[model samples]
Target: MPSSKPAFFFSSTQSVDNRLGDVFSFIWGSYAGLRELWWQVRGFNTQFPDLHISEIENKFLAGLPMPGGIDFKKLFVKTDWAEHEKDFSRWILFDVCTLYEGWAEKVCKDLFSSSTYERNAKAIQFPSGVRANRQVSGYPVAVNEANTSASTLMKDEFLPTLKKSYLNCWSFIDQHLLAYRFFKECRNSFIHSEGVVTQDIIDKHTELATIQAVKPSPFRNNFILPSQTLGQSIELNLKDCINFATIVRKLICTFDAALSVAMASEAILEQRIRNLVSNNPKWNNLPSDPAKREQRVHRMLAASRIPEPQNFANMMAWMQSKGII
Candidate 1:
């Protein structure tokens, strides 16, 4: 039976079980809850069907009393949103990690799989420290050549592949991953060093990012640019991340379809073999053939769909040709 494991694969190093759990927790616990709060206070509206922009300023400012009497957290809870106060403040960070996990999973499955791309991603087999160090930390780890692991390749080449392969499987790669990377960096500072990341940091960097993304191109419409401000910047980044996830999911669906076709073909081949035996007169003369009976008894696979790894190579090549490899 074809294995149903690939669709569920998120990351190669991390167990699929762990990665999926994290995604569900982040989306439902943090993103969804905060979105609900945004909806109640300010009102939810969207120009683009899938794009939702909450009345954030109105919702936040409406509850504020200029004087000292009102507790912000207390007022937040009175509206039944108190439960998500912590998440509201930290949703950006949670999304950052969640999107990162999603992208990491696709990369592992698309680029590192032994069955696809025919690349060796496992640890190198050098016997000496000199060779080991060089091999392990080898530049262009893309393993475009046999006996190499592509994981160590420089970002320019690897990232393009990562993006393209992900695109083939998804509608778009959300720029949110880049934002999440920065968010994770900021989160680490707060968590590990007690460093402050203020609006200034986001504004300056976000403006620069806007320029880069806005550079003229035939495909310019594919990119979305946001204004420069800490909240706006972070929001834009988050959008990118969400878009990227959508792309990855799409690719998985494509691969699933291919697997179904392969399984159907296998069934057809099996049926043909049976027809050949029934029509031929040579074996009709002999007693009920044990070999034929054994062949007929071959197990029919369960009527379930699963990912077949054989398509990985074709997927990799297609992605690489599109500059996503």
Candidate 2:
């Protein structure tokens, strides 16, 4: 007699649970680090008023050439503190973008892997000559590493396919994908150009330039070249970085909630299937062949016409109506 339990069920559920914890933990830790950096910047400003006053007065009165020959007298005088704030902002923006991209990749991989497991466990056949035909030993390589962009993942993968009930949980993050992209571009500019404000960088980020306070005003003043306009550079300030960090935190919360919903839904379905099999003596004495037993269970579940529940409440109601509770 076969057990009739799906072999992949337990492992798949556990994998999702563990990965969700890891993702949230990483996001929270990153947010904490960003806060610490913010405080450190404030501390530096408070402790070093003399540096700003002395440097600004000397550079102005002595007519010393400031960096890039930008006149200190015309610009706001706190050049040293402003430079520190700009550099810190760039650092935070780059790292936060990296964290976000990494999380997106991880979640996508987890979902695809789970879907693949379910299909294989049910022995669901795929069309011939399709990408599914590239399976290695009965498992398709569904982990998409090539196109990990947030827009692509949300539009093409996450939003459309996630259970309807979980969509609302992800809505806020989905709506802010453009903001994420802007940060990504900033990270790229810093890494590739060594923070140079080139015409190409300006053109690439023009859409985000209209955004007031994208960079800290004082920091922005320091970077504005005589030949360059305000929107022509890739400079950012500490305040801008802090605001972006808050956005990232919100995204993390939304994603965490969605994953929780998904996990609960999976658990409910698993329990329903188990109860169905356990309550039937026929299922208990399934065919000796494991493949045939699995097919029997799959057929029975499909015939029940009980669609997969989207959340715990839906699952409870369905189970109650079917006298499964």
Q: Residue 314, candidate 1: how far off, in angstroms?
A: 14
* RMSD after CA superposition, every candidate: 15.1, 16.0
For model 1, how does the per-residue alpha-carbon lDDT over 1-325 read when each residue is reduced to its tens digit?
3332333222332243345447657666756655565555433323333332233334455666666443433343334543344344345455445444454344334544456422222211001123544653221232223223222122222223333333242222123223323445445545654435446446535633654465452122233433434332133344443443343344333222222222232333234334544665442343356554322222111111112233434433433353321
Looking at candidate 2, what is the lDDT of residue 108? 39
The all-Cα superposition gives candidate 2 an RMSD in Å to the true structure of 16.0
Give candidate 2's total backbone clashes: 0
Can you list the residue pairs that collide in candidate 2? none
**TM-score per candidate, in order?**
0.35, 0.38
**Could you give candidate 2's per-residue lDDT for residues 1-325 as a string of tens digits?**
2233221122333344345446547655765664554455445546666576445445334664545554433333334546645656766676666665555455434443555444432221111123455644211122121122223222332333333432222433332333444555567767886655655545434534434234442121222212323345566666666666555544444443334223333443456566666777565565667567555544555433233222434434444465543
Worst-scoring 10-residue span by lDDT in model 2: 138-147
